[model samples]
Target: MKFDVAVVGASPAGLSAAASSARTDARTVLIDRDLTSVPNANTIFEGMASAACLNVEPFSIHQVRGMRLISPSGHSLEIDAGGHFLDRKGFYAHYLNSAADYGAEIIESEVRSVSRSADGMELFLSTGDVIDARIVIDAAGVDSQLASSLGIKTMRHPDDVAWAIEVDVRHPGIGEEDRFEYWVGSIAPGWKATFSPAGEDMATLGVFVRRHGRDVQRFLETFLKKFISRRAGSHPGLERMRILGTRRGGDPIAVLPGRIVDDGIMVTGGAAAQSGLAYSMRAGEICGDVAGRAALERDPSRERLSEYSRRWWRELGFEYILGRASLERLRSMSDDEIDRLFISLSGRNLLVPGGLWRKSANAAFQLTKAMPSMLPRFLLNLLRF
Candidate 1:
């Protein structure tokens, strides 16, 4: 089959890319290994969902008012951030249907390999069929087959990838909670333990640990015990908390790939180390619009397709850099240091007004004031990028 644009993977990124490309009048196709599997549950800010043009209300299971940040020593801070917990199966179905409505062909086939063709690019599918396209967008997750076949390096630091495990549980106390909870510091080294309640008696508990190998199950077990005890007193009946399901995956938090765009191809989403649901969706849209136009213009050259990279870097690059630096700094600090830092800033509100830069600056100032020792390292980390 031949097309103007072909997107690999049916992730949020791939679906968005296909829809955007087709919307631009380009003949677009989206291929995935399996369309029946449910997507992992995730939470995103309401603004982010809107910005990505996703009508999340239909699939939303719970409305989130804010987040409670818990320190290692039990100190806590509340931040007001509006968002929602979505039912993944319904959400993906909605997105998939929307992509089809935009005239993008959806294919349930694995792309075994990708190679350069005289005209543009060729996708070798597991079904013994080949697809030819003027431009290709790789939105496959961390294990992107298309990227690997093309000899492209998609992760800057593989070891920095966060290994995570989450489980859905039915607990009596979770139904009334409106705020997401995050437990930071040594509880889950290099990342955090998260409690995201989806509905009354339905919630997910997960832990993300970087450089911790594959023993994340142990971390989850330990965290579950501690969390249950803390929330339900001494007689917290662990037997009553029914675990419905489990999911595991790698999160490329600080390992952003260096090159995402090349001749006749562009990479977005987890494959390119672009984490975050809304962020990846937005990136896919930008990539699709650029690649679609380039395909129609018959100019899929690296120079011509570099516009996607330029636009993405101009828009979300700073936020990514800042977040990476902050995460790296957090990873370097001891549990005690984090606890002390949280204690010092316990009563201070972090939801300040202004753009990302100003808010970040204000946060830095607040951190420096609370713990003067972190200022030098924080400044150095920010300056390193």
Candidate 2:
């Protein structure tokens, strides 16, 4: 196969990269190990809105009113501008199809090795085929093989990595409400256990905990049992609810890498430590657009593609810094401290720190006043790390 641009990974970043490159009439090819298990970011409402901006439908989307934050003792706070819940499978399919529609060839194959020469880059595939492209985009997730092959370092440190487990459940009372519930407790220790609704009768319950010296399943189960037991009395449908499916993955909750562009290559999305769906989509679109123009000029050199790296950081670097600091602070907080943090922020706009911190200066100020003790941790992490 020969193309002007070859994108590795079929996730949001790679798909968008292919689409953008092809839009410039560049011969684009998107390669993935398997099309069926394309990873999902769970597609937040803002992300769906972005997909619309990119002219792609989410396939089937469920609107969520807001998120309800709960303390360890069960105090609750709800935010009004909640996010969207998406049909994961449908959204992935739509993204892939949209890329193909843009004249990007979709290929199902794994890259066995990667090499570069004066002419371009070459990828040897496990299917006993070779691919040639003038430029390469690595959008593979946390365990990115191509990035490694290109000598790119991991974006996150041990402390910045988290183990996440999500289980789908058919709970009668779960999605009946417009708001999702999040609980902070010992089971999830600094992090919160989340119950995100998918439909009237389906929801996803999950958590992400520090990856150091812990059993992922055991922690997940403990959180599930305690959370369900507490909410069961109120909902009355918890007694017979069964797990429909389970998914486990690593989460890189860290600042973006210092550089995402190298000779003949660009990296984006989770592989670049752009964690949230909205952040990843924005990064992907920017990188893709830049890569498309660079490929059109027949220049994939690091100096040429550095514009993509600079634009991403200029627009989103602050949020990524704050997000990393927030995650680190959450990990350092005691259970009681987590409870206090939630209680103080309860009913006050629910501007939860990770993705939601960028909204409302007043909310951010109020939170600082409420949890003055966490400031040191946040600053220390931001400065030291």
Candidate 3:
């Protein structure tokens, strides 16, 4: 088969890339192992949903008003951040349908490898078929075969990738909660234990452990026990809380790959360490639009495709830097320090309603007042960008 742009993986990034490319009148194809597979449930902020043009109302299972951050010592801070818990299957289906509507072809086959062809690029599929394309976008999650084939290192270190284990369960106490809960500090080590309610009687409990040696199950078990006891006020209903399903994967949180675009290929999503859903989708759109124009102009060189990289870095680079720095600072702190910090900021609204700069400034002010010692290090981290 031949195409102007070929996107590997059916993740949000790939779907948006295919759709965006096709919208530009490019012949786009999206390939994946299983196009119908349901993804793990996730939350997205309202601003991101707007940026991605996603209709959250139709697919949202729960409307979130804020987040509760619980320190290891049980100190809590609430931040008003509007978002929604989406039904993953419905959300994926919506994107899939939209991509098709935009005239992008869908292939239910795994891409075994991608190689540069004389004219463009060739995708060798598991089905023994080859696809030729002027440009290729790799969005195959963290363990990306295409990125590996091209020698692009998306994760800088083991600690940059978080092993996550999550499960959906039915519990009486988890009913249509407006806030997502995060238990931070030693329990989950480099990350946090999360409780995201998906409306009536259903919620997901998960733990993301960084630099963990494939023993995330243990962390999940520990988190479950603590979460149940804390939320239900007892362990009496623990046995009755039926687990519906489990999902496990690697989430690239801290570092992104040094390179995302090459001679005729670009990488996005987890493959490029673009972790968040909205962020990945936006990256995909930028990548696809650039690739589509480059392909149409018959110039798929790295120099031409670098526009995607430049645009992405301009739009989302600050946010990624800020988030990574914050995570690093949190990882450096002890449970007692986190508890004290949370206590200091307990009643304050951290999510100031304004632009990113204003909100970041407000957060910096509040955090400096709470933990004056951290200001120098945090400022140093930001300056590195």
Superposition TM-score, candidate 1 onto the true structure: 0.95
**In model 2, where is the ten-residue run with the lowest total lDDT?**
51-60
Q: Estimate the lDDT of model 1.
A: 0.85
Ranking by lDDT: 1, 3, 2
TM per candidate: 0.95, 0.90, 0.96
Once fitted onto the true fold, the runs of candidate 1 whose alpha carbons sit more than 4 angstroms away are: 50-55, 234-236
Better structure of 2 and 3 per lDDT: 3
Best by lDDT: 1
**1-385 in candidate 3: lDDT tens per residue?**
9999999999888888999999999899999998877756487778777756666778887889988888987877887878898889888999999999999999999888888889999999999999999999998888777877777665555356888899999877574788888888976544788888888888888998887665688888888777766766533576569999999988877766568898999999888888888888888899889988999999999999999999988888788889888888888788888888998887776877767788889999999998898899888766765
* Clash pairs (backbone) in predicted model 1: 175-200
Model 3: CA > 4 A from native: 234-236
89-200, model 1: which lDDT tens digit per residue? 8888888898899999999999888889999999999999999999999998877767767777766777888888999988776745888898988765447889898877
lDDT of each: 0.85, 0.74, 0.84
> Candidate 2, TM-score vs. the true structure?
0.90
Rank the models by TM-score, top first: 3, 1, 2
Q: What lDDT score goes with residue 235 in model 1?
A: 29
